[model samples]
Target: MDTTSDRSRQWQWPQWILRAAAIYNLVWGTWVILFPHHLFDWTGVARLNHPGIWQAVGMIVGVYGIGYWIASSNVLRHWPIVLVGFLGKIFGPIGFLGAALRGELPWSWGATILTNDLIWWLPFAAILYGVFKIHSDPASRIPSVTRGSLEQAADAILPRPQSSNGKSIDSLSRDQPILLVFIRHAGCTFCRETLAVLATRLNEIRGLGLEPVVVHMSSLEEGERLLLSHGLHDTTHISDPGCVLYRHYQLERGTVSQLFGPAVWWKGFQAAILRGHGVGRLSGDGFQLGGAAIVDQGRTVQVFPAANATTSLPIASELRTTLQCAAPIPKAL
Candidate 1:
């Protein structure tokens, strides 16, 4: 792929747009972190029993501000970050509307939504549109002169990445079959649900002779923190900020219907609000889809690619049923 640096010079407004967003997020997050209950008081909502939980949410937003600041240098190359932020901005208000209708929250709460989410919609959308046009243009597309196949993927063009705990996938699964679970950015509620689900089913998964190896697109440090909260920080995880492994496995970027469809909205609400897997800001590639595979000896046995953002992560029984027809597993651990 050609370097986006030269192409990035073609655009100017996106840089400023992203920088402004970064500054706004940083200041807003700082304020919320320092006074977690201030926003609620201003909005006429009762104080929370757990202000620390709200403070943590502010921390997540503050982290996103850092990501936005890094991305401002090359908006075109960092379009995924922008996309995630845009989606969050779009959906944040909708979530607010749902609360207002249920009478659990007051309309006064919208003031923060205006600054934190609504105001950024158009500029963010414009930046995304500009990205779309660039990607749509033939000249802007990276030449396919190089081979980016799976064979080469296992042997990376750059050095292959290791799991968060300093182990390699080949080393971990060299002897036995492992469940390769590729998840979305750490911020996605579905991603959190996937991790939480896997945490509960760890023993059951090993019972099926498959150890879990998670793949994500967040920095190793952020991945560590996210997984630690779910008690899976010790689980094998690979940090692929560039998503090279994702493309190698043929996981493509999702479309509008795949990501933001009506069904997705309903499932998101249920998973986020009802299921208690609350969402977060963009911590990685927002457009990238996720999947799972059973691998032993460098090849996939059965692939379970997610059809959409909210597709349920397969459970232990589901894996057992699916692996029934596949190769026999060794009983010994």
Candidate 2:
């Protein structure tokens, strides 16, 4: 199970929040380091016995800012950093309360806690909660990949929903080879690119004696609309919002770099901006990853997990070569 994927989803807050937290920490740390007395002066609290300790605390807070900055790159992978920061934010106030009660710290010191720690609690907490929720949900769980024969894997995707007025996946692949195309989302720029390529090469694919079926984590209506827009209305599709088959086939989620790196951004620019295919409303889990497979006679001949969100599907020529290579040789007379 790719826990990172689960982290990426359902927490759609902009990256700027993390960036802002980082900047705030750095500035605040610098201020405290240079003028620890300002806080004491404003709160009317006597200075600490060792003012250097306050400076040391500022240094620690600034280090946390660096952690937050790194986490901004990919919060899911670097979640422990955020967890530590959140804990500090929580404990800072509790420690303050104990000090005030003991007359060791001024009540006004809570104002510093408000600015330095309390404000960040909810957003950080929200991210952690989202992480917990995704892992706990049985429906979205990612099943481990079985290191067994293709026939065993095929069994996992069984009882698959029949395509609109078409045969079940098992039935369709029983007599002929089928290319299973797992799509990321209908609104993805790369997915649009995939649609355009398939629409242009459908005839060539047919000539190679391969049937392509699309699996998406969106409603049937949304899938139909997207395919129709791309002139692929006739493409066979299966809607699996629960991602049951996805997990069964071991299609784990993508990581931060895989989904939103520079390469992905460049490809997206070409697809949506330069190519004039505008982005659409998100129709499925934006973080749900995708891949491809060749299923024949209840057996998987090839599996191609997408390298990233922007990965291109293997073109028809590539699939043809793979099929030719995997085909059984003629038996001796």
Candidate 3:
């Protein structure tokens, strides 16, 4: 029943529509970048009294607009970037709404918010919807993680032994519920901070009848060194250099790359800024990455995956809540 003509027609429409949307976003983004002050004036957010502040705002908005243009142009190829842009489009308006409701934001900002937020929402939504449609099409079917499969896979992938440890993950937590703290490699400052927090909260975590097991994508030697530096030498640790666990738990990078195409410069810039301020330090080797998941008895009870390394994971309380409701598993005999 399917012919070349039928296939060509099917591919033709979506591609044409996507290209049109990309052009629109590119044009709009360029406009905003070229005249950020005018765009801000139109939006009614109070004009910055300081030229320095205006310059900063212009730089930020211009960079974001360029990101939007690139993402929209290659929606299918860079779906993650497009998705992030869409998130900004949606949340930017919500933020304005909240500001207006609280009387902290001026009504004038709504005009610019309309241009930046509301105007993009429909198109972004359409692009997202189209992406899903394409993904769902019979021709484009790809294996995805469902809750059930993910739970099963998480169990299998997580319980392995590091060659150095000579101990299995399950063996380390035989007497208590394992608090598997999945972390990014040493390149992430947040991960280092998290290790410090875990050290500080060791007693509390143990009090809850749980044993902490730290997981990272570094070598066991590197992981141990980092943990020792933070005075967490006693905590059990595992190295997952290949990110096999990351893939198994569906903690892969999100849609950001679809727009900006792996932002090495941005990542480096952030690292430089962090280091300059004495706030955070990036890995000298540039192995910066992010994603975390908590598993218990083969079930993915919690995930804190981010599109980029800059964001922080939820704190201990939120992590505990996620673990508390972890799907029940059979008690060991």
Candidate 4:
């Protein structure tokens, strides 16, 4: 019979396998990056219509290779990078399925997506899950706080402190509803557009007796600049660089990359064409996108969970409607 220690030792094999997979990713990614055109030619795919395109592809593949190499070293912080890679793999196949359904791509494309995306998808997920499990466990604590709990704690730990601006969360009217819009860091175009929209409709939200709190991961100065750039100086702005609020509110989830490896370029092209822009690039390469959650009275009442990178959350109107009928907002004061 195997002893407990022996079983524990047996469990170590998965980590070794994960390391091997990481090495494989690094090698394959490097080949693709260094010989992109040659790889495409050998695969019978046309050289990208533009020379710069191939260069960009090479650079991206090279970076991905570096990421895999880092992840293989068993660095705890790099797990998110590994998760993004897994998402890329998964999204690639799903895109193929969509293409096949629309009769836009051949069955071979679907096959390619399957082999590239689904292959090792499960194992990668298991690896991530195992890592998170260990990290969450007190013995192996990774210093993570759960989303639901964190949000509640934020309400208590970081009470709306009064500042020069008299518009703190504490000062807001108790009878009115509040919209806490969490914006991404400066690099996110979607967040910028979303902020613009909010700015345009700031009065409309105010007309509905709703206060809008613009939350972002930046310095107070940066947050103020973002608001000013968007013509939203009057909006309440807060900065939380540690993503403590994001994690506490459970809005920090992002898709993995293995799900996206196959179809990313194509989707980028589609987006570019749709927007009438010659250059098409998927935002953040189908990973590293944030999520949204709505809460009231310290309870999560609504969550617009993302199925994948391509899926869009409901717009402001829809989100508002959903929140309207949600459980009553808590009166923390």
Candidate 5:
């Protein structure tokens, strides 16, 4: 396959658009710095007491132009920069709309919003989506798992909890079905999102005869803090900072698209912002991916590899449907 040829053909328009945005940013930033008062006069905005602050904002916008120019060379690799720009673009418009509604900003200020934020939204969003679509198509299948090794892998991950009173995952699966949920770092917004979801649905899941066991790549104390905040203070979780169980279950590290693409940002906004599960301090590798598996006795029945770090989980009703489709439960561990 000619990857270079493919990339060249696919990226022609996107590269042009990125460069266009770079030029626009440079020109706009220069204008704002050279005559910051012109913008206030034109938009009917009140003059800022500190004009230098406005000029500094222009400098930041001009710096973003440099980042956009560099990103045009490889939009997929430099997507985080693009995402940051896009987020700014998104929030800026919302801020302007709010201020205008409150009569703090003139309606004419929308002209700046139109040029600085709205116009670039679609193109930046499209580039992000394009990167996601292109990168998500797996190039090849993962190494095959023979039954013997698969069982070994399952056993390695579901071994008895080291504490004296803790039950093994295998033992838990023996009497009923189990939902083994792998999580990223404790501080990840998506991890907090997952905790939020589970906090609401855990009882319903238990009613469906499935016990949810959370696995995290963080210290137990940190994991407890995240879970407890989300009303999951009593949830059973495994803290595996080394990711030993993650590898055994074949959860790979995330790529840039999987971690920071358009879809991730959108869903993250809903989870971390709209849902009020605010992000917090970093606890572990932010790029570590997670997954879910259904276990019955010692055998793994179903696996859902996470498409991205921020993939929204299936709701309780959906899990019930999956549980219905899973392999029959056994009687003993």
Candidate 6:
């Protein structure tokens, strides 16, 4: 795991690369604009009938240079700029090849292509890869820890995972075993599906004597707002932003197959598109998996790790873990 500072450092290379690219493009554009036929003469090609057309192309490249300069500040945030530029770089060479083969352009012009387009391919691809990694895998935002440290932290938190209301899981579950429901990033479609299920089956869960305590990796206010939106105002909420409880419960970071497998995609489509449990923006660690457990006296009596991001815990009646729970919270105002 990495921290915010580390992630910030990881993005530095892309920023610098983009900045250099911006300067290079601006200088190249200006050079082409000022002496449109200079490169044609160097490349041993006759001047165009209207050199203004080439200057117009130079103008367009200059505009792209401005976009790259803007994008350099936040490479990940301005992925579209990189994406378009990358495409242009790829296609520009192809166009050059076609012209060179048809005798409209000299092979010597490929020298310009190498500098203008070929040189940027790797760094541009790396920037795009960084963007994809940062978005899909948020583990970089989490603090680093060893297995021993994680075990110690989890040991301390699992029995006493602090709640928004200042009560500990151990204290709250002393009598009525709390159904500790762990969910992934708040934006996940399965998270929405699970919350909707809990909200719809709140009465059913309480009827079975399990006071559902939803543990999430978000702020107290954010957890409350998301839960309240799902009509789960009465359910208890635990804000575990560090995922100590998650590590304690053995819900490790999901694998690629578990998180983005074909099955998960289909299920996500079903929940988001068909069921209308729309996804939201990322709230916390996107890599963490979700699970459920019945905690009695802060000790896990029954555990149910989710099979994948798409398959959530059957929280209400289907939980094989028979909970010896009672006394649900009073209705929210």
The top-ranked prediction according to TM-score is 6
| lDDT by candidate, in order shown | 0.78, 0.75, 0.57, 0.55, 0.74, 0.78
lDDT of 2 by residue, 1-333 (tens): 664555464355725667788999999899989998888889887888899999998898888889888887767667788889899899989998999999998887787889888988888887775554455333433333542433353446323333654666677688687788888777888888887877887888778888888888677787888889889877888886656556656777766678779988998899899997668767666766788878787767777788888776787768888897875422100
Where in model 1 is the C-alpha error above 4 Å? 1-160, 327-333
Models 1 onward score TM values of 0.56, 0.58, 0.42, 0.47, 0.50, 0.59
lDDT string for model 3 (130-227, tens) is 66545423222222332245435434443332633566555554545666666655765556656766788888877766677777766778788888
Residues 209-297 of candidate 5 have per-residue lDDT tens digits of: 88787887666676667667778766677776545566667787787689889999998888888988778776655667888877777
| Candidate 4 global CA lDDT score | 0.55
lDDT of 6 by residue, 118-147 (tens): 999999997886677565543333344433
TM-score ranking from best candidate downward: 6, 2, 1, 5, 4, 3
Instruction: Give the lDDT of residue 211 in candidate 4.
Output: 67
* TM-score between model 5 and native: 0.50
Q: What residue pairs clash in candidate 1, if any at all?
A: none
Once model 3 is optimally superposed onto the true structure by TM-score, how far is the C-alpha of residue 135 displaced, in angstroms?
24
Worst 10 residues of 2 by lDDT: 138-147
Question: Least lDDT summed over 10 consecutive residues: which range in candidate 1?
Answer: 137-146
State each candidate's clash count: 0, 0, 7, 26, 0, 0
Residue 141 shift from truth in candidate 5, angstroms: 25
Off by over 4 Å in 3: 1-164, 254-294, 297-300, 304-316, 329-333
- lDDT: the better of candidates 1 and 3: 1
